[model samples]
Target: MIDASLPEKLKEKISSFSDYKIFTHKNPDGDALGSVLALKRILEFENKSSEIFVFNSIGAHFYFLPGIEEIRIQKEFKDGANSPALFVLVDCASWGRTGFPFFDFAKKEVIAIDHHPKRTDKEPLALEIIDLSASSAAEIIFALARELNWKIDPEISFCLLAGILSDTGAFKHSNTTPKALKAVSALMKNGVNIKKIADNLFRKNEFPGQLKLLGEVLARASLEPRIRMAFSFAADKDMKRHGAEEEDLSGLANLLSGIPESRFSMLLIETGAGKIKASLRSETHKGVDVSKIARLFGGGGHKLAAGFEIEGKIEERFEMIKEKIAKESASWRI
Candidate 1:
């Protein structure tokens, strides 16, 4: 049965923590940003005060959403008079992953309304609306509205729709589950322009992004029978050369899998941001747990799809990760 106490719990949480602040993961993605902003907007309607903060910086592209002007960076929150006490970290599985490093926090209750798979760091969470089977945390937020009977406005629908498209690769990835589809379905019923959200996310790559993709594909393209791996080893110079943004890194791993016989593909992108952002794909099986591979580098996601940012060089971990995949490939086959 649907949890009867959920609505009361959320309402109580909102009412009791009327002056809470909302925090999200570093390098805020659409899902993380959208979840927090959407929740913040709804809470305000209930006379609850909340602010959305990012653990790091985001770009203008991400700021294209309706409530985009409201996001405050993590550092900005610290330097200013702190918002409210009750801190709510949205779309993140754990505190460590939240990117604020627990700065001067005194909130009695912590809430995690996310869809990311629960890792070890996710322990000690006060309230977790973590539906691992859901496509994105934004999807979970929509479900939260239905289950808790919160109003779903156009802005909320737009944010969640963007997140669904972003996290699900515009429904290209296999992580797009039945619940995901249904959540988007509900949003469409609420008057969200699914196509506009799609155009914003999938169809809006800039010139530099296109160049980066072509360069990455050219530089690190590797093949092992049916498998493919593309890599881009660049520092400041290369980024300047291509003007590639981190979001451009999102779908690179799938690029390798598109070729014939390559059932899986991986992208080992060396970022100017001092981390190797990984994206993975599987043309063969939707049950293969890529999260394990991502967990090695402190990342998490669902089976058949996952990604992470490596602290060290992609070149250093490249061989080890490749060998690891080779050893585990048989188990991954459908």
Candidate 2:
């Protein structure tokens, strides 16, 4: 069962508010957007005024989601327009993750919902619903919907299903628990098109350039047999050479994690000069907590998958991470 007190408190807060603004992290994935959109639809169904505030463009793969067009970027959101009484943050672990203009907005009543491990560095908010055991923030949303006794229409089902599917790697990831599977079954009963959502999320229609980039990154992958870990890096130059964007690097870590001998995999991308984004993933049975490695660099996520950003030369950062990982893996009996 889920936490009763948190959902009940959120229900009371949601009931008291007529206008609300939803916020998610920058470069939002399906879990982030899906959770936000699903919540927005629910509030609107109750005759509450709600809008989602996100920065950056969503991935093209998510275009099939209902109400996808209504999402507004941070720049487009006008300040003080509706005087929203409540700010609902979904799939975001910390206030800083909300990005840009929304982050600048002074503290109002906040309801933060997420499945990621909490960062002790960040202070607690007015209402926080965090269940790291849940597969995704969408899973928590599904639970909340049940607690509120809201109707689960097809659109809502699709949104929540997408979130859960995406975050759990289509239910193949380690976080996919029995409860998550039960939730998916319920969503399917609500008329969610499972095959269509799965195809859209997992089967990407790759452009030639993206294919080239993927090949290049994979061609240079390094395997550390001692730790049963593999890693690869892509520089901005490499992206330009292949005519690929940062989004094209989406599944690189997952791809690498599938290596037969790899207990974990890491993918580092040069987002900008002297800035690197690192993604990490580990096999569920490896007994390695990649999230701990990520936390050492000020990032937080699930044990199997996590990521962090560093400001340094790609080579320098990679070496630093390698050393850190090596030290951490030294204690492993594998």
Q: Which candidate is the best by TM-score?
A: 2
Assess each prediction's global lDDT (C-alpha) against the native. Answer: 0.69, 0.83
Show where candidate 1 strays beyond 4 Å. 1-4, 76-84, 103-107, 121-123, 208-213, 224-237, 284-287, 323-334
Q: Estimate TM-scores for all models.
A: 0.84, 0.91
In the predicted model 2, the residue pairs found to clash are none
Backbone clash total, candidate 1: 2
Stretches off by above 4 angstroms in model 2 are 75-84, 101-106, 225-228, 327-334
Q: Report the C-alpha lDDT of model 1 over 1-334, residue by residue, as the tens digit.
A: 2255665676676666658778777778778777787888888777777677776688666767887788777554452344445677777766667666554333346677777766665256566666667778788778778877788888888888888888888897777788789888888888988877777666655585557656755576767643233333444345556666656555556665565655555666667766777776656443345666677567776566667777667657777777766666556552
Q: CA shift at 28, candidate 2, in angstroms?
A: 1.5
**RMSD (Cα, Å) of model 1:** 3.5
Worst 10 residues of 1 by lDDT: 226-235
**Model 2 TM-score on a 0 to 1 scale:** 0.91
